[model samples]
Each structure stands twice: as C-alpha cells, then as structure tokens.
Target: MHFIHTNKSFLLISALIMAGLILQACGASPETTPQETPLAVQTELAGTEVSIVTHSFPASAISAQEARLSTIVMGTITMLDVNEGDRVSRGQVIARINDNQIRAQLMQIQAAKMQAAAGYELAAAAFRRITNLYEQESATRHELDEATAGYNMAKAQLEMLEASEQEVQEMLAYTVIRAPFEGVVSRKFMRAGDLAAPGQPVVTLSSPGLLKIRAHLPENLIRELTAGETIRYSVPAAGIEMDSVPLTRVNSSGDQMSRQFSAEAVLPDAHESGIRPGMFATLHLSISDEPAIFVPQSALVHRGQLTGLYAVTESGQAVLRWVRTGRAHEGRVEIVSGLRSGERYISVLDTPVRQGQRVSL
Candidate 1:
C-alpha cells in the first residue's frame, strides 16, 4: 500500500511538469516582465518674448477740482444746510456763521451814514449861503474861507462813514458759506454751533466726475511718462480695468519735501461705470521693453524663500532646478539666471512633481 501511494504521488508531479513544458513549447502564453511607468507632464520652451516691462505704482483717485468751504469771519456756525455727500450747485449756501453780530454792526453803520448825509446837506446849504453873501459883498473874505474849510471837512466825514457802511456789508456777506461750483459735499469739518475760524474748513465740495488717477512716483519712473500716451489702469476696489486711456498730465517737478513727481490719467466716465473719487487705483506704466525668457507662474515650486521649477532633460527626465527670477507680467515670470534659452521647462505642474522623477512630454 505504501509503494502504491508513492507511485500515485510521482505520477501527479510528472503530469503537472509535462503540461508546463508543452504550454511553453506551443507558445500558448507569452513571458511577462515589469516595466517602469513614465509620468505625463506639460512643458514649454524657454525663449525670448517681447516683454513690455511694466511697473505698478500705487495710485489713488482724486478730484481735479476740490474746494474747502469756509468763511472769513470767526464765529459760531449758526446753520449747516447740507451734510456729507449732499449735491450742491454753484453759489448754493452750504453753511452760515453767526451773522447776528455782523448784521448788528451793519445797522449801526447805516444809522451813522444817515447822520453823515444830513450833516453834508447842512454843510452844502451853508456853503451856498456863504458864497451868495460873499458874491453880494455882504460877507468877509475870512468868513468865506472859514466856510470852505468847514464844508470840505463835513463832505470828507460823510464819505468816510459811507465807506465804513459798505465795508460792513461786505463782512456780512462773508458769514455765509457757499459752494464754489457744482459738486457733492465730501466732508464736513465743522457742524452747527461749532466755532468756525477764518482758515478752518466748514465743508468740502468736490466735483465727482472730475476725477483723475494721481500717482507719486520716483524720478526714474517719471522720466518715462508722457502726456497723451495711452496706458492701462484698474480700479482695485471696483475690479474695473480701463485700457487705452491717455495720460493727461505728467509733472516732473515734485514738491520740495516729497521729491517725487505726480502723473495723472483721466478716470473712466462715472456715468458709464461706478468708479468714484477716493477709490484705490493701479496704473501699469511701461517703463521699458526688452526681449527675455519667461515661464508661467504655476510652474514655480516655492520651498521656504527659494523658488524653483522642473526642467525637462533631453533624456526624458524631470530635474528640479533652482532659478533666479525677475519682473513678472500677468502669469509669466522672467528667468534671470539658472535657465537658458531654448531649454524645456515645466510651465504647468498639475501633479506632484519630484526632483528626479521620470516624465513624458
């Protein structure tokens, strides 16, 4: 029984070996081996392009015509007819100071003027009477001279008082503050019942549509600016971009303290857009133009403070190399060093690319 069991085991092993040999000889199944999978990546050639190097200097929207409303007289603000953001026309009253004192003075002057008029009338009548007496030889020469001096003094006194009265009236007019032009009330520095001084502003009136982009740039940048040159600008808050807008003014002479000149560009028409004064704006001024190699920003691998991108080799391998970058325009960045022209670099890395990973173009 043991010998029979051994023969049965040997027969089973022999049958399995013969089947494997027959399958190999007949080519029923081909040999299989493992292969390395290459990763798919997108690449672009690093070449020179006409890169218009633009600089973004901070800018603000400012009203071209702005006025600070106030009165020459120092007194308590009696009436404030408008608040901030109120629309007003030219010559419209915006605020009034305490004009009671001025008005009272005007009345007192008017009374004095009337008295001076009466005195002048009396002097004129007396002069005429004295002249008739002298002509008829009934008055002495000394008496006629005395009347002439007296009449002249009276006439001068009357004129003096009348001039004082007109001066007081002009002071009364200064108590009322009015808008200088058609504009909106932007700020209120003093409220009703507040003591207002000659220089202290009561309200600020600013023309809304008359806005310009004001930028304080360095001397180097101001040299490249020119009037009537179309450029690009954007209102950051409103997300509005206006291209082809001409630069209306460029001032090379800055204030003594600032040492930075100002340049202006016309703001977009307020009627067509929601751009307003005081909104933040960014002006892209093209300071220079040169041919340079650039790559997309997405390909940059930022590790701590260093920036790097994957460069594809001719041997179908991705090698991550550190590079020095320069000014960036839109989504592309300038490669200043570490990458040469005509070299292939990854522009868009949607996968987790490594330092020495194999990649397929």
Candidate 2:
C-alpha cells in the first residue's frame, strides 16, 4: 500500500510539471493584435448637378448635291481620263467611247454627199442646155423633160446624203462623256476597254461645298426635333465633333421595318471643318436637363462581369459597390445606379485594395 501511494504521488507531480511547461510555452509565444495595414489612397466625392442629358444616334455625313454620272452611248470605253477621287471641272471630258466606227461612217457619208453634189451639178448643167435647145426647136420635148427629172432626182439624193452626214455628226458627239458639274469623282464603275451601255453609271460625283448629317431616329424622338433646332454631330472614329449644327429637315413618314424616321442636319462650317461625305457620325440629342451622378473614371473597377467603384464606408473601410454606368464624357463617367451623390470613393490607391480593407484618406 505504501509503494502504490508513492507511485500515485509521483504520477501526480509529473502531470503538474507538464502542465506548468505547457503554460510557460504558451506565454512565451508571439501574439497577433489582429490589425491591418492602413492603405494610402486618394478619395473623391461623387457629384450631382443639372447637366445636359443627350442621346447619341448613329449617322453619316453626306453632301447636299451628289450625282452618279452615266453613259449616253452604247460602246466600248476607249479612254478614261479621270479616275476615282479625281477633281474635275464643269463640262470636263471624263471618258470617251470607241468612235472609230462612227468616224468611218461619217467619212463615208461625206464622200457620198460629195458624189451626189457633183452629179447634181452635172445634171443641172445638162438640163439647162437641153431646155435651151428645146426652146430653140433643136431638141425634142421628151429629151428636155427627161433632163429636168434627172436634175430633180440628183438634187433630192444630195439633200438626203447631207441629212445623213448631220445625223452622223450628232452621234460622234455622243461618244464623249463630260462632267456636268465641278466635283470630285467618288467612284468609278468602268475602266478602259469596258463596255458602257446607255444609261449605265460610269462614276459617282459628289459636291463638297455643302455638307449635312443624315441620321435615323426613333419615331417617338422625331416629334421633338424641329427644323432649326441646334444639335451636335460627332464622329467617334474620326475623333471629331461639331456643336450647334442646325437641323435641316425631318421626314414625316416612318420606316415600316425600322420604325425610325430619317432626319438631316446641315453643317454650316463643313468646309472649314474639312468634313467629307460617307464618314460615319453620331448625332447627339438633348433629351432632358436632370441632375445625375458622375464619378471619375479611375475610380471604376471591373470584377468578373460587375462594374463598380471602390467606395469608403463610414468606418474608413474599402467596399466594392457594383454600379450601372451610362455614357462617358471627358475623364468622367455617368453613374446610373449603385453610387449616390456625396459619397466618397477611392480615386487613387498606392496598393490594390480589398473589401473590408482599411484605407486612409
């Protein structure tokens, strides 16, 4: 019994020593304060103010006077003087058809006319001589009559030949094609040796003096547009924009398929702006004058499919707030939703931030 009690006491003392060692090791271990490093960041307050509410619609630049030049004669093209993009003057010869056959026919008619003229001259001389002989009773009446008939026939033939030559001359003139107005050739449909039929377009010409924007707007929006309303035109691809262009006209009829109405705006300073036809443009329409929230573009962060900004909470914690964005202007973007005016956002940060991360302004 004494041995068993001694063993129990030793076991109890060993257990106490192990517990004391465990406590000492735990006390000596490093402790974490659960603190996060503060991030240096720049913050901005979202703004809301009455601004122009404009809607952009696709459009294209067009000339006031555009034409397609066509051929008037059916023949093979012999000479093409001007190509696409060539500047031409009024009545300038731009193309010519093969006139060899017409020229040859004209020469033949002229030769025939000369022959007829000589025959008529001889016939007239013989008729006069025969009439004189008959009056003198030296020639028979039948002979004089026959000579008069021959003279009349020769004169008729000569007149017919002259008419034929005139017809040929007119045809020769038709072989040459000339520009009807002074403009730049926009396109060419035919080249040398190509067959050009009557009424077939050879080239397209556009006058650059007057320019306009052609756009199609929804039927509901057309009612708000007026003839002289001021608007804006922009070409995103060309990096150009013009303000205060007056609306020229609007079509009353709506397209059955597109449900859109066509509209036109004349550019008063097109020449000074160096605008050309066929360039794609955008037309901006002022729809309303309501206040909207706007934020700097640098504040936006895209994650997965969510577009949002890094906002600062009341406790100075960074929170990712998803937002709906509208059109962008300059360096600022319109915030449609999820972000309110007067709220602060981290516009710039030294290091990347996370949700619930502490940030210092």
Candidate 3:
C-alpha cells in the first residue's frame, strides 16, 4: 500500500510540473513583455514666410557731425552757462571768462578812440585854416606847408589809434564763448575758475538735426555699396530698429592699413527715437538676392557640436537632420543648406526622440 502511495505522488508531481511549463510558455508577466508606444500621427506643416534676399554683416555706429568746442581767448573761466546734456541754440552764450582786464583795456581803447577823434577834428580845422591863410596870402608858403604836414601826421596817428581800438573790442568779445550751432552739449571740459586757453576744448556739441551711421566695410564688399542704397540698422542702446534710409555717402576708397572702405548712412529724424550721438548701432548690408530655405528658431536643436532639426517624415517618423545655418532674424533662422522647401518639420516634439523613431505630429 505504501509503494502504491509513492507511485501516485510521483505522477501528481510530474503532472504539476508539466502544467507549470505549459502556463509559462503560453503567458508573459507585465515586466517581461515589450511595451509598445502609440504611433504619432502625421500632419501638414505650415510653411514659414521668410525673406528671400537677406544679408548680414558686421557694423559700427558713428556720428554724422562732431564738433569740439574751444575757447578762442586765454582767460580765467568765471561763469559757465551750460552743463553737459544742456540744449543750446546757435549764438547762445555758453560760458564766460574773467574779462576784467580785457574790459579795462577796452575802456582804455575807447578813451584813446575819443582822444583820436578830438585830435582828428582839431587837425582838420587847422589844415583848413592854413589853406585859407595861404590862399589869402596872409601866411608864408613854408608856414602853410609846415601846418599841412603837422595836420597829416596827426590824422595818421588818429587812424592808427582807431584801428587798435576796434581790435581790442573784438578781443573782448572772444572772452565770452558762444555756441556755434543749435545742439546738445555732450561734454564739459572746463569749470568755473578753470583756465581756458585758445584751441583747448571746453565743450563738445553735435547738431540735433543731422545724424548718420558710419561703418567700415570689407574692400571686396565696397564695390557692392552705392549711394542711395537702403539698408537695415539697429541701435540696442537706444532701442532703435528701422530700415535705414539710403546711404548718403560712400567712401569707395579703402583704408591703406585695414583695407576697408568707409561708408555712411543717413538716418531720418522720424526714426531717431531718442537715439543720441555716440550710441552703439549695427548695420545689415544688402549684398544680393537669392532664394534660401529657412526655419523658425524654435525648431532648432543642438546636440554636442552639431545643430539640426527634428524632421517628421511622411511615415510619421522623427528624423534628426544635420543642417547648415546662416543669418538669423526675428526668431527665424536661415538654413543655408541641408534643408528644402515644402518639407514638413517638427517644431516642438512631445518627448525625447531618436533618429528613425516613430512620432506623431
């Protein structure tokens, strides 16, 4: 009976083992099963509207007119009427030097001028009287000639004194510096009590009406620029951005050292927008017109040392494409090469993607 019991147990254990193997082969646990992600749907992508002909180059800002203010005469500065950033009109008094000595000299000149006038009058009368006497034969010829000569000498002395007085008056005027034009004062080099010397700058002013941007261009590119050609410019410091009016002047000649041509563009007053002289600016020169593929900046992806885009294929698969980029503007980047028009691209993907990986639009 015991042997019979052992045989039944063996049969039961064998049957249990076979049943377990069958179940394992027929079913899989959640952890062992491969997960399948939902396939992404393909959709039509909107075409990006980009400029057909665009060129970008390095640029710089320069003043259209710059003037250095200087004192015309040497004197101790007594008063300064304008400070830096002060607006001044043409012929407005900007500053004054201590002209007490000058004024005293002017007064002496004026007194001398009066004395000269009196002497001239006396000489004229004496000459007239001597001529009458000679005509009446009441005076000898030698006496009349001596009187005439004396009168002429007095007249010459008076003329010389008058000229000297006028010169002194002009010199006095130079003690008070005046604005040469209507402009804003950009600098103040001298203050009250400071000694001002001739040809030394005391202030700097620039015209408020005239403005331009100056930049140096490569010698090879100089031939492409011409007067009256419009370009784009930006001034970040002044928050100015506008399509610059045509270049009013172009120095076609290149610099001997840098071999760069000097160019200038005139800016309209309407576009000034608080831009001041010496503000930084940039210029975008137009070289040629050509068709190019472009993409929005949002679609770009950087991986290591490469820049590319995740392009969706017709089969709804993400294809990472390496691309060559060019000038960028207004959130759009130029695809110089490695891209074509009418191709759909993924601007924003939902999750991490790989090459040839299935994706949805």
Candidate 4:
C-alpha cells in the first residue's frame, strides 16, 4: 500500500510541472504587452461662406494745393485782422503794416505836383502874352520860341509829378495785406510788431471748396487707378467721413526716390465738415482681380511654424492640410491655395489626432 501511494504523489508533481511549462509557452507576461491607446475622433464642420473679391494698396491723404501767404512789400506789421483758423473772404484785409513812410512820400509828391501845376499855369500865361506880342510884331521870333520851350518844359514837369503821386499811392496800398481768395487761414506766420518783407509769408490759407487728397503710389499700381474713378477716405482723429470722391489727376511719372506715381482726388465739401488742410488720411484702391478660396480666421490652427486646418476626408479620415493664405477682412481669411469652396472641414477635433487615421464623425 505504501509503494502505490508514492507512485501517485510522483505523478501529481509531474502534472503540475507540465502545466507551468504550457503557461510560459503561451506568453502571458504582463510586462511584454502594452495597454491599448484610445483612438482620436474628428467632428465634421460646415465650411464658412466666402465671396470672390479684389484688393488694392492703401493710400494716404494729402493737400491738393497749399499756398503760403507772404508780404509783397516790406514794412512793420502793425495790425493783424485775422487769427489762425479764421475764415476770410476775397479782398478782405488780413493784416496791416506801418505805412507812415509811404504816406509821407505820397504827401511830398502831392506838394510837388501842386508846385508843378502853379509853374505850368504861370508858363501858360507868359506864353499867351508872348503869342500876343508876336502877333502884334512887338516880339522877335527867337523870343517866341523861347517862351514856347519854357511852356512845354513846365507841362512835362507837371505830368511827371502826377505819375510820381500815382506810384506812391499804389505802394501805400501794399501795406494792407488782403486775402487773395475766400478761404480759412490755416496758419499765421507773422504777428503784430513783426517786420514783413517782400516774399515773406504772413499767413497760409486754403480753399475749402478745392480740397483734395494727394498720394504717391507705386508705378505698378498707377495703372490700376484712373482719373474720375471714385475712392473712399476717412479721418478718425477729426471724425470726418467721406466716400467715393472722384480722382482728379494722376501723374504718369513715378517719383525718383520712391518709384511711385503721384495721384489726387477731389473731396466734395470737405471743409464744411471741419476737415482741415494737412490732415492725415487713408486711401483705398483696387488693384487686380483673381480667383481664390477663403475660410474664416477661426478655422485656422497653428502648429509651430505651420499654419493649417483640420480636414475630414469623404471616407471619415482626419487630415492636417497645410495652406497658403492671403488678405483678411471681417474675421475671414483668403485661402490663396490648398482649399476649395463647399468642402467639409474639421473645426473641432478630439485631442491626439493623426493624419490618415480613421475617426468617428
């Protein structure tokens, strides 16, 4: 009975060793196999509606005509009738200079004229007497000739004095500076007690009705804008609003330094709205027309120097497409390439997505 029990115990031990070998052959170690990773899912997004459009280079506002007022005659400025930003009319007095010297000279010329007139009268009386004497044969022919020469010289002297007086009067008028045209005085260059000289500026004025914008544009853009074409302008600082003003002129020649052509646009009643001369402005111009696709700025994704969008393929695959972009407006960006209209894009996606990976919509 003891020998039978020992054989049974050996058989049990052998069976247990065989079972352990089978478990190792099956590769059941926990360290060998990794845990399963979660798959990323992408959501379908409706593409933004885009419109075909054109764009152009921006422009700045400039003065169409700026005149610097100067004195035509030299004298001390005694009175200034207008201040800066004061409206003036044509022929209105803007300033006055001291005219005491000119007035005194005019008076002196008047006195000389009076003396010459008396001399002329006396000469005429003497000539008439000489004529009577010659007619009666009481005067020699030489004497009559002498009397005629004296009379003519006296008359010439009177005429010279009269011319001198007129000249003095005209010079005196120059002391009063008058507005050349109806405009607002944009600047005051001189003050009372200041000496004004010929060609020296006293005030600078601008015509409100003739207001316009001047800009320099690149040569390539010159062909895009033309005379009579309308453009828009705005002044945020001055709170002025304008639109569709006709372009008045364009210089075909480009600037030597900037290689840009000069352009101008006429503003309609800009002065009435307090749009002062020399105010800065912006100009918009259309340059060209080209076809392109666009998307909202919100749909863009950034990945370290790569700007792209999440796209969902027709077969429900996640794709990260790189794209080129153009101008942006109202939160929409132009997709110059790499996108098409009416295509489905993935705006939102589950984290850890990869390209060509199947994703649940």
Clashes of 1: 0
* Number of colliding residue pairs in each model: 0, 0, 3, 1
Of candidates 4 and 2, the better by TM-score: 4
lDDT of 3 by residue, 295-352 (tens): 7777788888899987787877778889989877667788876667778887654456
TM-score each candidate.
Answer: 0.66, 0.50, 0.59, 0.58
Model 1 has an lDDT value of: 0.86
Q: Number of the top candidate by lDDT? A: 2
Q: How does candidate 2 score on lDDT?
A: 0.87
Q: What do the candidate models score in CA lDDT, each in turn?
A: 0.86, 0.87, 0.77, 0.77
Residue-level lDDT for 86 in candidate 2? 87
Top-scoring candidate (TM-score): 1
Question: What residue runs in model 3 are displaced by over 4 Å at the alpha carbon?
Answer: 1-66, 218-224, 252-261, 270-272, 288-361
User: Which digits, one per residue and each the tens of the lDDT, describe model 4 over residues 187-291?
Assistant: 898899999999999998877666777777778767777788877676655686546678889998886988988888877677676666677777667544455
Q: Can you rank all candidates by lDDT, best first?
A: 2, 1, 3, 4
Please, what are the lDDT tens digits per residue for candidate 2 over residues 7-120? 999999999999999999988969889877788899998888566667889999888888887766689998887877788999999889998888999999999999999999
- Candidate 4, number of clashes: 1
Candidates, ranked, TM-score: 1, 3, 4, 2
lDDT of 2 at 91: 94
Q: Which parts of model 4 are misplaced by more than 4 Å? A: 1-67, 99-172, 208-210, 214-220, 238-242, 251-262, 271-280, 289-300, 309-353, 358-361
Report how far residue 224 has shifted in candidate 1, in Å.
2.4
